[model samples]
Target: MKSFDIVTLTVNPSVDKSTHFSGLIAEQKIRCKDPLFDAGGGGINVSKAIERLGGSSLAVFTSGGPVGEMLKELVTKEKIDYEVIETETGTRENFIAVDDNTNSQYRFGFDGDVLTDSEVEKLLETISNLKPKFLVASGSLNEGLSSDFYQKVAEIAKTSNSKLIVDTSGQALKKVLETGAYLIKPNVGELAKLVGVERLEIDEVNEAAKKIIADGRAEIVVVSLGPQGAVLVTKNEYEFVPAPNVAKKSTVGAGDSMVGGMVWALSQNRSLKEVIRWGVACGSAATMNEGTQLFKFEDANRLFEWLKNK
Candidate 1:
């Protein structure tokens, strides 16, 4: 297999199905438009977002059963290269429906099949073999998968000299901090939880993230503040880029897009300032589309230009 500068890992991927409905009512059949199925999950969507920006990444994920097979087909259709690990159980599917009347989006998610111990080992082995320059481990873990899973990945990255980018929450994230990573994208709320705080004011976000940096838990911590924007903090430097306002159609793949943009930028040797802006640019651009459609390159480029001046 050819080596890629960037590689993404998704343990609990899903086939995302979305559609629009007239209204939401119980005990009555509400008609909906035809559904649209897309390959999703954190790393998969990150790969898709990278592709949208004319960058390439190899998506590594587990797949099994019929839904897993469909997920493979969807990825192929996207023209993204991928390597799959077969699992004893199938991948899961997620549903998103937009209420046309109120324009509210309701999302329903299902649990993915539990990964066996052997499957987990295979995933790590495959990732170690790849040894990409940038290793992105994103999304939630499957039931029964240990919270230390990302920690194990962190170790492999350290050995391979790969820059690890972790995007997760809770214990898994906590464990990753033990071994440390090259980068972590934690929202403000998650950042507060990491430092054992209930809430954090905007001004306090930098100090909290700096604490993590001071502890050597992460080399660079990017704190995402949703519509408010994001702040990138390192041991010596800090940069905050405000989110650009746009006509948001949906926020389906915004976070993943941000990761994709930042990783792609890093791989291209972009400065930290441009990296965060590209992240915000791609993220905000993703909201300009409806339901898991990521972002168009033109939209992202325009947004990036507009952000460069900010």
Candidate 2:
């Protein structure tokens, strides 16, 4: 097997089908346009985003049945290198429909099938064996899988000396913090919940992130403020970058794109400031396209240049 500098793990991968329709009505047949099929899920999408920026990473994900086959085919079409841990149940599919009348996109997501105990063990073994420079575990856990799934991954990363970057929510997110990761990107609301607060405002992001860092949960905590931008907090450094506005299309893979950019930059030994700029740049650029199409290289470069001065 070829060695990879970066590796992404997607416990639950998905086949993303997107299309446009004139309107949304109750119990009526809605005329729709031709569908676009893409490989999706957090880690896979992050790999796609890295590819868009002329970077490469190994994408490791679960596969089963026809949907899993299709997802693999789609990822192959993107020219992404991948490793699949075959399972008994089929991979999930997500539907994204655009209401042309209202210019709104409606996303319907399905829960992935449960993974057997043996399958889970195989997954852990696979990750433990591949000691990449950066290990990214993203997306939600499969049905019947414990929230500590990512926490276990964190432990494997530690043993391998791989810097783990986690992007998840709820119990899964909370569990990983207990094990300690290299970095975590939680939006304002998620951060608030992690710190046991009702809510958090812009001014409170730094202190909240610092609290997590102080607790040894993570070395770096990135608080995403959506349109307002993002803030990066480390043990002794803090950086804030305001988001650059652009014509919006879809936000399907924006967060994944951000993680992709930051990880890629880190692998290249770029400065932390540059890391956040690339993250915001790629994330903002991803909004220019529809569906799970991450971002274009040209757009990301342009945005990065603009952010360099801002």
Candidate 3:
């Protein structure tokens, strides 16, 4: 066993296709240029962000069909260590359109095909073999898989004595908590949905977080509040980490970058407060880039320093 620092599991990965549009017109031809294709999933993005931040992680997920093959090639090109389990159904494709004139973006997504029970078993077995120090379960569950799919992964992580961090929504997140994950990263909207409440105010954020922690489902609850930064809630602590004010760009992948930063900090034995700083910095840095490309290391470094000094 190589004792990897982090192992990321993505159930539904995709080939993200981003194209630039000059502008939108009613019933008019809109030519798209500067198309960019990259392998994307919450976990895959996190792995890429980790590498960019000088951290090490192994990318483990399932890939199948023709899209799967291309995705495998993409990961290989990025030099990311990965284990791909063959499946019967093809992976998904997510589309993003950027406006060159206004520097804005529009995104469209698709749900992935169902995974057979046997395929799920194979993934569970593969996860057993790797035994990474920490496990990050991100993205959505494929069709036919129970909402508790993340819960099962959490069980595997616990049995292997690995810390588990879950980034999911709705019922899937609810079940995953039953398995006792170490951390959960939910944005404001997601947090509201999980608890069946309206949007959360900064004052109410801690209350919502406390409800989840009271059940002993998760040790740490990170509620990302977009431009307002994030709130960290634990049994005995509640702290709000503010984002360094910066010009806003495309908002894609900012949350995932935060996850990557926090996990990297945890791997280095940094304090939770310090991890929050890194996470906020990464998210702020991500807004500096366009489309799906997230946080540059140089920008993240500067933001981290500024955050620490504040």
lDDT of 2 by residue, 111-178 (tens): 99999999999999999999999999999898889989999999999999999999999999999999
Off by over 4 Å in 3: none
Candidate models: Cα lDDT each? 0.94, 0.94, 0.87
Model 1 error, position 10 (Å): 0.4
**For each predicted model, how many residue pairs clash, with residues at least 3 apart or on different chains?**
0, 0, 0
| TM-score of each model, in listed order | 0.99, 0.99, 0.95
Clash pairs (backbone) in predicted model 1: none
lDDT of 3: 0.87
Candidate 1 matches the true fold with a TM-score of 0.99
Instruction: Give per-residue CA lDDT, model 3, range 38-81, as digits (tens).
Output: 88899998898788888889998788888899899988877788
